[model samples]
Target chain A: MTGASPADTAVQGTVAQPEWQQLDRRSIWVAPVQPLAGLLLAGLVAITFRGWDRFGVIEPAIGAAVAIGVFALSAWHWRTTRYRITPTHVEMTSGMLVRKHRSVARDRLRSVDLTSDVVHRLAGLSVVAIGTGRQGGESDDELKLDSVTTEEAERLRRLLLDRGSRAPAVAVADPGGPAEPAPLARFEASWVKLAPLSIMGLVALAVLAGGAAQLARSVGGDEIWRSGPVRGAWDWVVATPILTVVIGGLVGLLVLNAVLSTVLYVLFYGGYTLVRADDGTLRISYGLLTQRSVSIEERRIRGVRMDEPLMLQLGRGARLRVVAAGLGTKDGEGKEKKDSDMLLPTAPAAVAHRVTADVLGTPTSPVGAPMRRHPVAALRILLLQGVSLALVPAAVLLMLALVGLVPHWIWQVLLLLVVPAVVGAWLEYRNLGHARVGEFLVAQGGPAGRHTVAVRTDGIIAWQFRRTVFQRRPRVLTAIAAVAAGKGTQTIKYALQDDVLPVARDCVPGLLDPFLEPDHP
Target chain B: MRLRPPNNPVHPRATTWWRLQDAGFYLVVLVVAAGALFWVSTAWLVGVVAVIVVVGAVDIVVTPPIRYRKHRWEVTDQAVYVRTGFFVEDWRVAPLSRVQTVDTKRGPLQQWLGLSTVTITTASTAGELKIKGLERGFAAELVEQLTAATEATPGDAT
Candidate 1:
């Protein structure tokens, strides 16, 4: 199919410009409110410590004036900032002292993502983020225009996509025609949405149990709950069940948590709808508690991974997480968060593959061989875990012996650690495997759960073969693969014959060329 | 794509300095671990310190050499060749046409010693090929050369 060129898509009809309107003044309050909240809390603490009488009437009046001044200054700054979307580009200029101007070329725009939190929604404004593929000689290319009208945002999206289609290209088609939108996938909310409810219920139960234990202790003894340690045997008896029942309740709560989690997942993802725009952008709108709309361009996706939790694999449910760069949210620490990169929560394996192929243009290939660890590796992991557990009892006995109170029945502690070690090792043995299916390399291993990480060779940014002197003795090596996301690194520890390195080296370059080569696919 | 010889090859002079620095680092780590073991009585603390020192030393000593015997770079074609390591050797072939940016940096010591480092970032991965201990002029020239090559290539409309 020939895509419409930017020139052909340019508006041929008369262009209408909307009247310049100022956003709601209240919207400006958000920026200042954040800092003000901290200041207000600090002021309250100081006032409480000093006492109202200590400050007199002047203190209250001064506090009120200072709060108002801070709010006013923030509001003024917010009002001065302005953003405009024209037929050619989206421009924004903000700042009171050092003015900043950002203009995103409509013809170069990839996609526009709009997000609104509770405050933004109440103020009827949204944060708009326009993604532009890597630009030459520019470090910061993504333009984010916060606090804009929903209508203006829509217009900007249309303008950018329209102009982008007209940019010079080898092949130009009917750009004036409306781009054909991709078919929207319809989904329904399922009972699995109740998962959150179950989780909340468990939390409530724990809170109640703790409260009950405190009440019992208060009535039984004159001692306060916070007062030092319990000395009497009766006190120990009372606290032990309080702790046991709480711990036991949590253990019992897991099944319910899983069920409730599943329910909640079903509720939100049950009626999921993913639509594709004529301009080749995917729009995902889902959720029950808080609905979210995510728009991503087809070219923006780096890779797709299909995950099957043990339970999900049995029931035919798979989680699809997309590894896309740029589309992420910042955490409280201002570091970019990875959770936002997920394109799909969970879907059938077949549906996940279809979405991957359609959105990412990845060739349909069989899942790679399951990469597994050598049997010795599992034994090594088990032995390490066993030793760690055994150390606890050994330490306890050693401490007792040092104090001249060593018990004759120290052998009982050894039995306590060995059983779990044996069981854990068996679990580890069940979990490791790796495979190479066509161009994709899949690796899986862990304890009770398996993590199958699959990536196309082209998507790999770097691969390193590492070996320790000890590992070399055992003829084992580790392969670390790096992806585009600044996420650290994923290493696959495996044992292979010495002759296998050449084969691996040859296979890796060919697979990674697509991702590493600038012009070749 | 026209490929050309690499402009910045690992200087033979830098290898001796690198080896000396690596050895010094390991020696300091060994001394610290031995001191900590003698001072700390806590088993956990001692164990942790021992693991850290041993792993750090082994990692430094066993790491592949920094020098690349065969290196190539083509400014016109936008590609680079880097072959490194002593025993388990590796060859990295990257294209500047695919590179997103070229970052040049110099630490205090490197600056005083008249050396800089260049990192070439690509779109698919964060891991970039880093060439260190190059003369400052060469690093800047490499950046300018790579930038010109990148700009010359026709932008992909996709």
Candidate 2:
């Protein structure tokens, strides 16, 4: 039975079998939430059946049947789940009716991680997942052992990752171990300052407002959320002086969004701590009730990103994320990248850069490389693009004006928008900088806010240059550097036509030389 | 473009493909224009039909020969360069290392003409680049060469 035909999981029977570890018995306490929901659904269905509405016993019986069935299934699943970590492989077998045996080779293991929620933590249990980093079949390549003790999760990560990779001699979180220098860093309560400044707060507030509005609409009582204050605000604005109205609306939105963001930031990143562990690994642990820990091997980390939205930038704050493969992009993996991959919630830009440098094992942050500006034509292109974008709304306004559908005064507002549009274009052009760092190419883009992404030049697998009819006129083209990790495409947009050849060559030297060489034409 | 050194050209029968496509295009347009004419005996419809027919004929007769002259495909040591698109010429370079897969396809008409299309899929989401109208033998060789080159360049970047 051990001599499996599946070659990837092959093991020599001569070796002592690894001890099989069952998940904490407390795991039974954390039954799947689906059954309760299913019970409710069953009750609803029971009601829909003719005459069942008049029979309370029938409804309760149906609810009890579904509820009991769900609980029984969860209990069985928890009871049968078993896993083991060996020197060369991590194996898992689980399932009530249909058994699933998954084994990943030590050499193939790319990630070892854990997660928990309030209920799981209360029961002293955590979910452990092992990954091969291969992409296919909805997380088939990953093996999950749900609801293990926190201590067991740490030991499994160390024993599996360290022995499997010839990783630096392992240490069990001992501060004084010669194997690991005192953590490169630990959580600082002050880092929470970054949380409130993060744009996630604003985004969260917007999402919350949208969700509330949608909920209101679905419940058929949107008047309270939609029109009550918003319409009142418009009326108030009409009554107030023009300057006061504009200022009041702007200030109110800004303040409310900021406060909401702060609340969300604290809730998610409250006890976040990042520590350098044995063998060039980073241990990231965070959360309040649902504490989780993620171990990132340096070898798997292809790049680090420092994101600074307008608000974060204004506060000199930046959030850090690792641009690595298999962390979140793939299915049945890290469910929320925002919560999982974030290295820093929010920190002073300088401190964030310093941490970036430390994790990257370099004195200078790759993202810190000074960006080289795009040509002046790029600025012109940006302005023209912005103007064209505004033209659509302007055309609609004109059409509406013809029908007396909109105030002609609004035309003046559209006219006024020309200034900001141009300014925005100018800002975008300024941010559209590209630079070649050591072994990495940096591409920065965006307007008002900027995203400067740097990927190892060696990691880039493909290059693309697209020139439209409009771009041809301006002698500019968009060049994309395709990497295997992160969002995949890091674009150098609106590059001067003349600059295209040199940039392409620099990104991957000699690849485009034959095509770029000028011929008789 | 007129003076550019000629690179590898696809099969001569590619012109048949282009002419057939052009005919199909005009056929659709003709039905729509004729249907409009049936509704109103406008004299302008005749003029429009004449213009369309003339343009379609000229294009059918003229474009494929010139386009076959411009379209080129080559495999470099570093990358696969495909130059196509007559008016707005697109010259793409897919590095051998970045090639994820190489495939060849043939339509019914192409099969009758022994023509095949070679496609090179790369990691970049720029959409795969296709070299069409290759002689079947040449297309197969191209796929083999691309696959070998891709394997030869271990861990090549996109």
Candidate 3:
């Protein structure tokens, strides 16, 4: 395994190309464990649902045969998959019958992500996925190495991103170099206190509730209600005062949500760290069970986004996302690498700002700078939109009541929702602001989750201003700054035409000059 | 403070193409509604059909010219500017330096009329600007010009 083995047959005749290497040998055993476990879980579920007595010897025989087949296939996959990083391109060739070859130019490489699931971690292996800056390509756009030694993964991350240093192939420096990169931020146990403030817990709860409802329906909902413990609980609930029951339920849900959120946060970002590596790349590594590391070229980063959800903002916590081009990619499972762009998880707002500044190489984070507010008419427009949106459900309920299908009280109760609608509109109006500070253009908006994005003016590729029919009267418009980075477009929503035009012009300079009419004459 | 309208309007034959498209679409809608009318006996649907007929007639007769006026495009040395839509108007501008690709598309009607739509794309997702209803020869020329301009620019455009 250590020598320039016969597997290098693909590159044997080539002169200057690097030798093609196979996946880690241990992955043949380790990778199979995950799928094998899934098979076992499926078998157990079948036995549990269809009774053990129904599980005949032939079933286990077939299962064992399938397991062996899966292991053999995994080993075969390890044999065929080979990758090499040449000076100009990082190339991989895999598959048996189909024969697939993928090559991404080193210059076009945007991100190198190293991910190790629990099984891979146990075997000390990592999967390296290299993403290019190509737009709108599917999973084929990424070059993936399924399993490699952790040291190899680290070396690849360094060599691929250190294009400026030009240390190609095996001349890579050791990790213990003299100038160790300082971390911009690291996970703190105390930050767990901010986890509950994130909407993750509620989102988890909603998913659980949905699953529970689906399970109940499948198993006959009446059977669950008719059960002894559930029956007693329902009786007690009926006997208790409405206020007490409601309060107790609310308390229970809150406690459950807090516990769930904290556990998820820890599992997802246990040893999180944001570091600017000596290779001129920003490396963010986190996750407890499935360790993941994302390395992005610092030069490719266009901006930073500080996402402060209403709950998180109330708790003085924020999540930061780097606005970079090649940070977006899908893993082998076609799951959009969810946290690939995350610079920091929910943490203290002060820490988020500090990390933002450090990452952007600025003294003060532009996201925290004071911004120009939208005109008062913007608020009026939002209020009208919100009230009209709130009225839709109330109107539906009123129509139902009129038809004698629903009680009249339902519609009346729904009308009270107008209060929250108005409040939300007010919050959205307050968040509508944009400003230009130094070389960055900052825009913030959203009602429940406010995002303040600070994009470098030079990164903006194009400018678009749209006016809806309703907004024409108010003389307000949504100015969208189209960039080739994160989310593609940053919007300054509902700003007065007069306010947005100058900002747009100043941000891109000559780009908008041909279109804009002089305000002077 | 204000934006001057783009310089060039689409080819005159675009009005005929748009009218044909509207006719095809309203024909489908009319057929579907007439089919649904068989299963249900609702008088309001008759009124709905009347409204649809009026709207479709107005769209075929009047909208083509209005859309032709609104859907204007211009290509300068620096950038490409496009304005489209009637009720909900849109203005898109993409600089030549950031332009990624230029493509020409011709639908069946456009092919019949010898007209084409030129789409200019930048690296940004929202940066695709289309100039509809240009002479096929002119569209090809525009694509060639845009390709040359984009190639001359240095940087990765991002």
Error of 3 at B68 (Å): 1.9
lDDT of 1 by residue, B49-108 (tens): 778777766655544243434432223353554434445543344555556678888766
Docking class of 1: incorrect
TM of each candidate vs. truth: 0.64, 0.78, 0.91
Whichever of 2 and 3 has more lDDT, that candidate is 3
Top candidate by DockQ: 3
Which candidate has the top score in lDDT?
3
Better of 1 and 3 by TM-score: 3
Order of candidates by lDDT, top first? 3, 2, 1
RMSD, candidate 2, Å? 6.2
The per-prediction tally of clashing pairs is 44, 7, 0
Kindly report the TM-score of the first chain in candidate 3.
Answer: 0.88
**Model 1: lDDT of residue B47:** 82
- The digit string of per-residue lDDT tens for model 2 on A1-521 reads 12221222224455566556677776765756534754464445334432353665765776678767776777788778777765566788888889988787776666677888777777777788776655323442567777777767766676566643332344234433475455555556666665555666568777876865655544345334354566787677688898987888788777776777667666666777778875556777777766777877667676777777776787788778876655544435534334556677677888878888888777798889887777787887788889888777777787899899998877767876778888889878878878777777788887777777777777776766666556666677677777666666678887775665576687777776656645344
lDDT of 3 by residue, A140-176 (tens): 2677888899988886777677665463322545575
Cα lDDT of model 1 by residue, A1-521, tens digit: 11222233354334453323344456676545656675666566455444456667776687688889987877776777776555566566777778978776655565566665556666666666676554222242566655566655554555565424443421332333465454435563442432333343455556766765655453333433433453454466566768786776677687666765665566455556677765556776675543455666655554555566655555565556655544444432245533345566666656666666665554652332334445475357456666678668767786776777976457456557767767766665666555555665555555654555665555555554555334545555555665553232344555452323433444446433332322132
A best-first ranking of the candidates according to their DockQ comes to 3, 2, 1
